[model samples]
Every structure is written in C-alpha cells, then in structure tokens.
Target: MSKYRVLVVDDEEDLCEIIRFALEVEGYSVDVVYSAEEALKMNITDYNLLLLDVMMGEISGFRMAHMIRNDPKTAHTPIVFISAKDTENDRLTAFSLGADDYITKPFSIREMLARVKAIIGRFDSKMKIGLQILSYDKLTINLEKKQVLLEEKEIRFTKKEFEILKLFLENRNRLFTREELLKRIWSDEAFVLSRTIDVNITRIRRKIGRYERNIVTKLGLGYCFEG
Candidate 1:
C-alpha cells in the first residue's frame, strides 16, 4: 500500500513534532515546516494533504491557502486549517478559501487522526465535485465547461465517454463491474448492450494514449482508474 504524504505547517516546533509523530504512527509520510513562508518556498504538488495553522508570523495560513488555491498545480489540493481561533467567522473564511476542514487547537489526537483519514480517503472525490475540475497529472477536466485536456491539449470525448471518465476519476482505485457501469452510465436507455461499454472503454483508452494504462482492467472483477 502507498502511504499518503502530508505537509504540516505550524509555528510551534513542539506542536509540529507532536502532529508529525502521531501521523507517522498512522503510517502516513509526514513533513513539517515551522512557517507558512517556508512551506510556500517548496514544491508542494506531491503532497496528498496539507494541515496548516491559521496563524503564524508575517505569512498566515489563510494567506498561504489563498496562494495555493490560485496556483493551478495545487489549486485542488485538500487543505485543513488548525488554529486556536475557533470563531464562526474564522471557519467561514477558511471554507471560503477552499479549506477542507478546520481543526481547533487543543483537539483530541484520536479525533484528529480520524478526520485526517476520512479526508484523505475522499478528498479527491469531494474536492473535484465542488471545484468542477478533475485532474491527474497532465490530464484535466473542466466539469462546468465540459472540457477535457490531455498533455495541455484539448481532447474531444463523446457525452457518454465524458461521463464515464468523470465517474472513474471521481472514484479512482475502486473497481466497477460491467453491469455496474451499464447501470450507472447507460441507465434505462434501451438496447444498450454490455459490449457497447467495452467499445467505449477501448476508445477512451486509445484517446488517452500514455495514460491508457491508468484505466486498469481487473480480469473478471471489472475496470478501474488506478491513478
């Protein structure tokens, strides 16, 4: 199993180590930085999640989050704010800036670990749905505009194909049987044979070229996007 990488940004060194130790015990690959300024200087694209403290030195966690959201590379990354400020307005501001969760200071370690696991498990699905964008490396979809880009170039997909791709991206690493695909994508449409789904899947693989292997065939089990 692959471990989830987490970047924890907080001003207090002791707190950072405590969080890091706890997350490491949970089998996560953890990194900690004492300041948001330091975090901003690094390439954060590879991290699966970010735990940021809202208050810091000159560069605050909210400011860092805004910058992260504005950058296309990290725009859709999951962010959870940890801070002593627990006012309603503070939480509202965090969510408005695309925070996935807010953790108040003096939180229970068990609760924090549970929240981290839950977010990492569904972060991609939830974040993609809200932002109207699903991306895996060079492949990207603008859900609102119904656009698909491969290697920074536009790619055309039929409506059915697009929907199937969206479903796969939303539920990566989960297998879907042919019958399940037909029910979800074809719905009540009459005369749609299971073979049609196979044909569409082939076409989608061909179109994606280098990423074709990302859509994995699980022998008798079914198909899944493994990215």
Candidate 2:
C-alpha cells in the first residue's frame, strides 16, 4: 500500500524523529523539518498534511500557516497545529487560522495517530466527493447525500445553502449570474433581493471555510463554485 505523505515541522529534533517513526509505522511517508525557516524553504504542496509547531525559532507555526493560506497554491492544505501550550484560547486561535486539528505537547503516540488518522480521513472523504462531490478540501458537499462535511464533522446547512451548492456543482466551470442564483434559490419575487443572494453566499462561504475560494466572484458576472 502506498503511504500518505506528511510533513513534520518542529524545532525539536528528537520529537520530530519520534513522531516521524510513529507515523511511518502507521503506513505514512514522513519528512522532518527542525525549524519554520526550513519548513518554508521546502516544497510542501505534495504532502497529504502538515504537522506544524506553534512555537519555533524566527518564524512561528501560526505565521507559517498564514503564509501558506496567503498563497493560493497551498491555501487548502490541511494543517494540524502542535504546541506546548494547551489553552482553549490557543486552540481557538489555531482553528481561527484554519487549522484542521491541534495536538498539545506531552501527547501520546496513540492519540497523535488517532488525530492524524481523523484529519486524513476528513480529506479523503472530501477528495472522494470532488465536483461529483463538490469538494475543495475543507468543505465536502456530497451531491448524492446532499450532505456537507466540514473537518470530518457534519454540518446541517439550511435549505438555501444546499440549493446554492447544488447549482454550483451541477454546472462546473460555468459562471453564475446573481440573477440566476437569486431566481433559482428563491421562487418568491418579493423575497428575491440581490442582498439575499449575497447574504446566503457569504453564509455558505463562512460555513464552507478554506474552500471559500472555490466559489469564485466575478465583479460583473456573479460567482462560479467549480474552480
């Protein structure tokens, strides 16, 4: 079986080695980087996931995640933050920054493995749902199920969200006009306002998280979700 490729970025050499070995044993291909600088220097796009340290020399893992998110190429890559501090606020910060998962230091190899597996499984389900699935990494919209998966967690979207997603997925690579979205999503002439369309789209994007870019905006046209 081919192993899932993983990038391990941490300042501690021994910790990196241990984590690498543990993941390798779980049938994953692992690469280790001792500092954020080295991690940034390495080509990280090909990895299935990134295990990043919150604190490191020069550049912090949060900074690195911000850099990665800024670059459209790696924007959707799943990232797990590893840190010595385990405050609720830290986790909030991590998740707010688009982290798929987080693990505190002094963690068990078994727990780490479980979390890693969960994160990988989330992406796997998303990939399996692509277009026919309407997936762009973090958001999993399964047309068949009319179900949306976020970070391996299921989210119950309102009727409007589902309809909007359905339209985009059905017409991949096509640009949608605001009028089209509004007309299609709402049948009542009175309720079909331009602001309604914009509001629903923003709600969908907010819930969609990370994959928000998949729903592209055209100043004159409208939006396309199939990119």
Candidate 3:
C-alpha cells in the first residue's frame, strides 16, 4: 500500500517535530508547519490527513479548518484537532468544523497513532467504492489514476489542466469564476492570473476533442461544463 501523506500544523515547534517523527516512524509520509498561515500557502490538497493545533498566532486552527472545508480541492481531506483545551464546547466546535477526531494535549503517542490509522483507513475504504470514476457522456475520468478518457481513447493533460478539468466535470452545469478556479486549483505561493485559467481551460477543451463544446463560456459569468 502507498504511504499516506499527512500534514501537521502547530505553533509549537517541538510538538510538531515530535508528531512528525512519530508519524514518519509509522510508515507515513509527514510534513510539519509552524502555523496555519504557512499551511494555507502550500498545496495542502495532496495531503491525506491534516493534524491541526487549535490555538495559534493570528489564524486559529478552527478558522483554518473552516477554510479547508470550504475549498473544493481540500474540502474532503480528513482533519484532526489536537489541543490542550479539553472543554466540551471545544470538542463540539471541532466536530462542527468537520474534524474527524479531537485529541487532547499530553495524549499517549500510541492512542494518537491508532486514531490516525483508523480515520485514514475508514476514509480510504469509503473512497475505494466512491466517485473514483466520473463519467459525463463520452468523457470519463478516473480520479484515483488521474486519467482522462474521451470515447475510449486516452488523453494527456498537464497537472493544472487535469485539475481544472476534473473540477469542471465534477460540477457539471455549475459556473465557476476564474477567481474561484484560482482559489481551488492554485497554491497561494504562485501568482496565477485569470488569463492562466483561461489558457488551461483552452488546452483542456482542445485535448477533449469532440467534447470541446461541452465546456462552455458565459459572456460575463465564467465557465461551466454543459454536459
């Protein structure tokens, strides 16, 4: 099985390192950041799970979690809250924000590891039988394989193009503004212009062949897949 990539976002440097080391020892790929701001700047959609600290400078983990759940690309990623605050209200807030689990501070390493394994395992099982293959008329895409097929013929797409097309296909008939595309597809580290989205969409349409017209442009509303 492939190792799951996990991101730990905490303001405490020592705690982050400890968690990172522990998770890495458990056969998982792990990355640690010291703040929610830093976490948001990176491409977090690639992570299978996120371990977030509830309290931090500027942006609290709860606020970050809200943002993550709102973004289409990262909305489904599993989130776990680790905090010293053990109030019932705190736990409720975490779950309300779509947290998979909440771990109190000074938790046993073994227990934390077990919760991580269980949550990721459950999500993996669900995805194996869920929307892995999406079909819209003659166009089909395998989310797991990142492959696109048109009329049974395979088509090549750049990473960004594939992501954009996947978004369009997943939400057929829903118009997506260029700003929304940039927010969902590109990381904050990159300065992507609206023209960049247009170019990628053009390439996606060209590669799809006969399905080109399925991706329609509204005069002032942005883009959507008519299929």
Candidate 4:
C-alpha cells in the first residue's frame, strides 16, 4: 500500500522541517509549504490530511481551510489546525471549518502524531465503505464518483453546492437550520455567513431545474428537501 500523504502549511521554516522529519519517520509522505498561498497552488487532493497554521502570510490557515472545503476534489480531506490561537471561540471556529482536530502551539510532537494517526485511521475506514448512490426526484448523486446526474445529463456542481444538495437529498423533508448547514458543509464556519448558504441553495435550485420546487424553505426555521 502507498504511504499516507500529508501536507504541512506553516510560515515557520524550522517548525515545518521538524514536522516533516517527524512525520517522515512515521512513514508518511510529507510535503512542507511556508505559506498558505503556496499550499493552495499544490494539488491538494493528493494529500490525505493537512496540518495548517492559522497565522500565515497573505492567506491565513482558516482561509486555506475554507478554500479546501469549497473545492470538490479536496473537500472531504481531513484537516487539523495547529496554531497558538487556543481560545474557545477559536477552537469553535476551527471545528466549524470542518477541521478534524486542533492542536494548539506548545504541543508535544508525540501528541500531534497521536492525533494525526487517530484522524487518519477514522477517515480511512470511512473511505473503505462501498459505493453510495442516492436519488431524489430527477437528481441522482454518485457518492463515490462525486458526480451528479440530472435526468441522465451530468451536471457540474461546485464542491460546496454538491455537498449541500447531497445532505438535503439524503435527509428529505428534514429541516436544516443555517447553523446546521454551515456545520455540516464547511470546515470554517466563521468565514461562511448565513447568506452564503442562501447563495448556494439558490445556485443549486437553478442547476437542478424543475426539481427546484422540491426544496422547501420554512420561514423562521430552515430548508428541507420535500421530494
């Protein structure tokens, strides 16, 4: 089997080197980038996990996590934030961004390794499950292929849009609060406003065409897929 690929994004060169050395010793294929921008330029889908620092030049790790979740190819890849920001709000922000774990700075290398192992083990098991295909009204989603078919015609969907649609379809008629949707679809909820959900839902409605009516909005509550 191939070694698990990991990307570490942090502005501190020394820290990056230490992490690279440690993870390499653990038999992982590791890549190190000093800036979030540099990490963005890479094929993020190539890595199974990302170790990100919150304070980085140009783009913060939080922003990087948002970008990753918005990309269909890397949306599901697990993220663990390692930063000095350890406040309750900060940790919540990390979890909202869909991060699997948060490791505050001044952490032990052994602890980091243990957390990484656990997160990877959990996700790997999930990936081993057989293919899943779900259909609602005229829309069909191939979970394994990450493809959507609308009445037999393949439709392109942004990663976030596809995930939103999939969640609604799978839980048909179940109301999903804006907060719930953000938690379910995004890795960094702080960056995604309630309006963002509205925008994605609008786009999804337009893409699915006639099936749009199946998605019902309950005033003062949230949205539900009634089909």
Candidate 5:
C-alpha cells in the first residue's frame, strides 16, 4: 500500500519537527511548514491530511482553513487543528471551518498518532466505497473530481454548493428539510445556520441554469430536486 502523506503547519519549529518525526515513524510521508502562508503556497491538495496550528504568523490557521474550504480543489481534504488555544469557542471555530478533528497543545504524541490513523482510515474506507459520478439529464456530478458539469460544460461551485447539489441529485425526488440538510451535509462538526442551506440551494439552482426550476421549494416543507 502507498504511504499516506501528511502536512504539518505550525509556527514553532520544534513542534513541526516533533510532529514530522512522530508521523514519519508511523510510516507516513510528512512535510512541515512553519507558517500558513508557506502552506498555502504549496499544492495543499496533495496531502491526505493537514495538521494545522491555530495561532500562526500573519495568516492564522483559522483563516487558512477558511481559504481551503472555499477552494473546490482542496475543500474536501481532512484537516486537524493542533493548537494551544483550548477554549470551547476555539474548538467550535475549528470545526466550523470543516476540520476533521482538533487537538489542544500539550497532547500526547501517541494520542495524536491514533487520531491521525483513525481519521485517515475512515477517509480511505469512504473512498473505497466509491463516490462515482452521478448524472441527471444535462447535469453531471463527478464526486471524485469534485466537479459539476451542466450540459457537458463545467460549472464552478463552492464547496458547500457542490455538496448540496450532490446530495439533491443523489437522492432525487427526496424532500430534505433545511435541518436535515444541515445535519447531513455539514455533519455536527460545523455550526451552520439554516439560512446557509437556503443560500447554497439558491446558488446551486442558479448554476444549473434552466434546470433551476427542477429544484422545487415546498411550502412549509423544504427543497427537493424533482429531476
């Protein structure tokens, strides 16, 4: 089996070296960057997981995570925040930014290794299950590529928008209340408001062009992709 690649981003050189050594011992291909800016410059999507520190120079880890989430290419990559800020709000913010897991500073190396293995294992299993392309009329969703094509023309969609469209197309004719959508798409990690789902749905419809009407909003219910 090919070794998994991991990127560790922290301002502290010692911490980066320590994490790199530990992960390498566990048979992972590890790379370390001392700042979020350097991490951003690299092809981030190449790694299987990101180990990010919250309080970094210039661009904070939170800001970096936000940028990663906004970029379709790296949006789905799993992130784990390793920071000293161990507050409830801090954890919430990390999760809201779509982090797979969060570990406060002064954590055990063994525990961190365990968490890394678990998260990567789960992602591998999902990949094995195959998120194949789903097609409906002129619309095509290539889950692996994270691309959406309407009438054979590629349409750019934000991370959330792509996911929302995928869910609707995969479960065509199924009604999804905003609450259900929030839970299903964002999971419990991110604190996404109901209004966010509405916004994404609107954007998905607009991108699909003439097929927009197929996504009907039921009164007192929710949205469903009739096509």
Candidate 6:
C-alpha cells in the first residue's frame, strides 16, 4: 500500500521533529515546516492531510487554512489543527476555519498517532467509492474518486462536472433535453433551472479535451454524449 503524505507545520522545531520521527516510524511520509508561510509556499494538495499549528509567525494556521480552502487547487484537502490552546472556544474556532480535527499540545504520541490514522483513513475510504469512474473512448471518469483521466493525466473535475459526466456515461449516445438532465442529475431537488445544466455541461465538455467535439449539442433539443 502507498504511504499517506502528511504536512506538519509548527513553529516549535523540537515538537515538529518529535511528531515527524514518530509518524515516520508508523510508515507515513512526513513533511515538516516551521511556519505557515513556508507551508503555503509548498503544494498543499499534494499531501493527504495537514497537521497545522494554530500559532506561527507571519500567518496563523487558521488564516492559512482559509487561503487554502479558497483556492480551487487545495480546497478539498483535509486539515487538522495542533495547538497548545486547549480551550473550547479555540477548538471551535479551528473547526470553523475548516479544520478536520483538533489536537492539543501535551497529547500522547500514541493517541496522536491514532487520531492521525483515523482521519486519513476516513478520507482514503471516501475517495475509494465516492465517485463513479466511467470509461468511454480515451476518457476515464473516476466518479467515486472524484477524478477524471485523459491521456493518462489526472483531470480535476468540480462536483457538478463529475455528476454530469456520470449521468451521460450511464446512458451514452442518448439525447438529453435540458429538463431531462436537470431531473436526472438533481432528482430530488425541485425546480433546477435549465441554465444550471448548461453551465455544468459546458464545464464537462471542456474537461473532455479532444473528445469535446464528441459531445454534440442538438440545437434546441438538448445535449448528447457521443464517443
């Protein structure tokens, strides 16, 4: 099995070293940075999870997490806050800023290791079956994984893009009117506008790359997914 990559950002060198050493022992790839500024410089999404210290020079972990979630590149990456501040309010603040988990300082290595494993495990499981992967021509849709591959390169699809792809692949070569697509994709939701389907289809077609021309628009009729 491939190891999970974890980014550990803490201003305390000794503490960061200790955690890094411990996680490495458990077969996790660990990257340690002393400040949020340095962590931001690195690619945030490449790591499976971020172990962030709420306190740091130049930028706090909370602020950095905000920046990360705002960027499409790392919006979905899981984050955990590690801080000495153990107050309820502090923990709430961390979670409000998009933290997946919170661990206080003075925590046992054993417990910390377990929490890390648990959080990453949940994310790993989710990616395995969350998206529906569809294969047509050279295009591959990893629907459960929320990923698409074109010519062997991983293509990132936003939530709506993946959903629209899944619907078309499930019924390939079939013509779908805008109303039908809205009903199929947003089944339970009442009153989804036709424009929503158009926007999603536009995004999906762009990701289709060379296959973009394959998906034909039937004028006023609607859209069809062709090989």
Top candidate (TM-score): 6
lDDT of each: 0.92, 0.86, 0.91, 0.91, 0.91, 0.86
- Give the best candidate by lDDT: 1
True-structure Cα RMSD, model 6: 13.2
What is candidate 2's lDDT per residue for 3-119, written digit by digit as tens? 589999998899999999999888999999888899888887888899999999889999999999889989988999889979999999899889999899989989999998999
| Candidate 4 stretches greater than 4 Å from native | 130-227
Report per-prediction Cα RMSD to one decimal: 12.1, 11.1, 12.9, 16.7, 16.2, 13.2
TM-score comparison, 1 vs 2, better candidate: 2
lDDT of 4: 0.91
Q: Considering only N, C-alpha and C atoms within 3 Å, which residue pairs clash in candidate 3? A: none
What TM-score would candidate 1 get against the native? 0.58
Better of 5 and 6 by lDDT: 5
Q: Please, what are the lDDT tens digits per residue for candidate 6 over residues 48-118?
A: 99999988998999899999989988887889888999999999888887788999988999998999999
TM-scores, one per candidate: 0.58, 0.60, 0.60, 0.59, 0.60, 0.62
Q: Write the per-residue lDDT of candidate 3 for residues 66-131, one digit (tens) a residue.
A: 999999999889999999999999999999999999999989989999999999999998888576
Question: Which lDDT value does model 6 have at 107?
Answer: 90
Worst 10 residues of 5 by lDDT: 126-135
State the lDDT at 223 in candidate 2: 91
Candidate 4 — worst ten consecutive residues by lDDT sum? 129-138
- Residue pairs that clash (backbone atoms under 3 angstroms), model 1: none
Q: Write the per-residue lDDT of candidate 4 for residues 28-92, one digit (tens) a residue.
A: 99999999999999999889899999999889999999999988889999999999999999999
The reply for model 6, stretches above 4 Å from the true place, is: 133-167, 170-223
Better of 3 and 6 by lDDT: 3
TM-score of 5: 0.60
